[model samples]
Target chain A: MHIPDNFLSSPVWASLDALAVPAVAVVSRKAQKSTDSNRLPLLGVMGAFVFAAQMINFPVGMGTSGHLVGGTLLACLLGPWAGALVVTAILVIQALVFQDGGVLALGANVINMALMGVLCGYLPALALFRTRWKWYGVFLGGTCSVLASGILALAELALSGIRMPVALLEASLGLFAVNAILEGAITVSVLRAIERLNPSAVREEVVRSGRATWSKVIAALAGVSVVLTAAGVLVASTLPDGLEQVANKLGMPFGKHPAFRSPISGYQINSLGGAWFSRAAAGLLGLFLIYVVCALGGHLLGRMRRSYL
Target chain B: MRYIFREGNTQDGVIQQLDARVKLVLLIAFILSIALLARPSAVQLAVCLCVLAAIAAAARLAVIQVLRRALLVVPFVGFFSLVVFLSGDGQRAWSILAKSYLSALTVAIVISTTAFPRLVAAARFFRVPAFLVEVMQLIYRYLFVLAAEARVMQTAFAARGGSTGRRALEASAGIIAVLFSRSYEKAAMVYQAMCGRGFSGTLSRAEWRPLRVSDIAILSAGLLLATVVHFISI
Candidate 1:
């Protein structure tokens, strides 16, 4: 889901843009480091291939057809960093040339699709590479990539003071689920077909055996993040006040502290003046805080282990 | 001759004649200002839209065409707005819809006015990564070629017969796989061609021309106007 401009509040879009630029830069650096020469045109052509992949339709038994989203496919073909880079490029082209998304919302789009989507897609497949359930990994990766990004998009909308009705929220989630399943199925089948046509074309990293411990950890972490993201969306949007009450009851001095004394301190941006401004603010801060803590801990532990070894 | 995306690059106009860097800074600053507007009623939104329309006219673009083209953002923004409206928050829904429309229109006008390459140059000048910009250049250059090939393949599939159930799935995969290998081969050829022609990982370009005094004046004037409108709306 490419979000348009003005869909996100100023703080929401601005912070996301802040998050995305660094993330994209780091991923771009990783991609560049992996390639000796600037094999940029190859990545660019693969990006075009992805755009083209969207044109061809895969029929899914109900007389309906679905096109490839290509996030997982690109991740499997190129490495994750390059895959994310390619998707980021596609989002840029879409925003500027195709008018498919908004320039202001570019950061949110990049975060949801390019970074999270690729990481989710890659982790599952990487985890299951040596197993008989390798195809299952591929399938799950495709599904998770779409689902993670879709849910994150929903959360972002919620954070922007979009009060989705229960029925509408459930319907959007259901649609995401269906699309995720279709993406998973498509990725698996396409992966199998590639192996059949040219065994050598698949990257050696996926083919060769790697340490399963790290993969499993990453895969589990990814799974947890997706679940947390979903829960975060629900809490932030629906039970935002309830959450605020809990924070208050826990003696959280959010307002008095000068550091925490920002515009959105009460989980509401005073300037925006939306009814649910506080609702979204509470959700983003509280739910996303948990995610940040967990993610940072895991990253530190991994670094420690790597350094010691 | 003009295309929707590559149009203003080949044409001449008042906005198009302004240096791309100036246009880039001004437009982005204006969009950010539009986003940061505290509360937008009919007057504020109308003013934003009118300003964009005036820019389109100044650029000699078809004003109606630019306005209508920007409506492409409507369906996506409309759905969420509908949700907010249903939940009985009318103001937030309207605010989002209007602001997003203004932002999209601003982008549409700028892109339709400036060449994509020149815009990229401006982005680079602002310190965007070189590698990322290069990839964008290649993708834009060849997006149509591969997309056309995919269209042809889909047509051939339809011409023979579109299958349902199982066979269709495998056929689709086969098509993607073929496209993948073909793209891979083409990339190899492109890299070789670039190398043969002394492309050492960077596309050659003339050095940036010094910004004209007029460009600076236009930029400052635009920024001041946007800031005024923004504060007035608030």
Candidate 2:
């Protein structure tokens, strides 16, 4: 799911943006090192394939349609590094050209759909490849990748201090779970088709039997799961359980603290008494603020860097 | 697939006339300021909206286009916002919805005003890796070609009584596989073409233009405005 701007607080999106740059750099570097020639064109064509694939929506049951997110599929076909890079490029184009996600939130979007999605998908596929259930890796990878992305997005929103009821979070999770299954089925069908048509296209030297790599991949996947679980716990603990008192106990300053009181402080408009209107207004104000601040910061940073050079 | 080509309306207004680098800076500044604010006041939101409107007008962008593009993010964000509302934090839910729309609008303005090639050139100026930039350009160039192929394939499928269902999905998967193989061949041909023309490992860089004094002035003014908005309490 492409997170729109203003859904995430500045700290959330900013840190994600920071993390994504280096992650993408590393991916690009790895991808460059692996291929000898025509790498650029290869990535370009793959990216186009992804973009075009996303446009062709298929009818899932219940009169709903879903398109391929392509993270797992790309990783399966191109390996993880090149796969992530291609997805990142597609995301960039979607944001800048299609306005699919927020420009400022590009970092988070890339991290969610490109980096984490690829890793989650690729690692599982790698581990499963050694087993009798080799083909099942595609299905598992596709499902896991989407689920991981959804959880990460929720975790980010929680970390940003946006509290929603447990029910709401569960609802979102449920939706993603279903979407993940569909994605998994699609990935499997597509991969199988590719294999049947041209086995070499889906074949890679790395997927061949190697014990050491399998252990490492499994370990990495375990580590990611552990970290995600811990993050979920952290999010759960912070929910409105005497939040104000906890902040006070922690010596966190609260209430009318800043010189500039946000027009909508605490997600409530002061003058408006109705809960919905105040909340909506507060939401609107929070969004506007984020849009202004991130845009400004990115601009100043770009300018300063240029001047310094 | 409705591909969004750059409008090339760089001759229309002050925003369009500004150097691509300067326009990028201004857009970033506006986006950064929005992101930095912990909670923007209603006044601040209004001010930002006004500023966006002013920029759109200056750039000669159609308001309807900007609005339509910005609305694309609503369903995604709106779903979560609805959940938040159901959970009783109506304020945060509304805030998410509003903020996402404004952010989308701000980005739309940037893309509409600046030509896509110039924007890509600006990214190159920022020292984004040459490989990444080259890949992006190639993807943009071939996106339409592949998309057209996909469209033709889908049309042919539908003509053969391919209604939406499980069978359609299976058929679509086959189409995708075929597309991947076709695109792979196309990539090889493209590499061959590049090689034929004395293909160096790197694509040729675009000509760089030094930032003019006027461009610097505009950037500074934009930054100054952002700073003023940031510090303003209301």
Q: Count the backbone clashes (under 3 Å) in each candidate.
A: 1, 30
Chain B TM (all candidates): 0.93, 0.89
Tens digits of per-residue lDDT for model 1, B44-159: 77788888888789888988888887787788788878877898988888888888788878888888887776787787676566678888888888888998898888889889
Kindly report which residue pairs in candidate 1 clash with one another: A267-A278
Question: How would you class the docking of model 2?
Answer: acceptable
Please give each candidate's TM-score: 0.86, 0.83
- lDDT for A284 (candidate 1): 42
Best by lDDT: 1
Q: For every candidate, how close is chain A to the native chain A in TM-score?
A: 0.78, 0.74
Q: What TM-score does structure 2 among the candidates reach?
A: 0.83
Please tell me the TM-score of chain B in candidate 2 relative to the true structure's chain B: 0.89
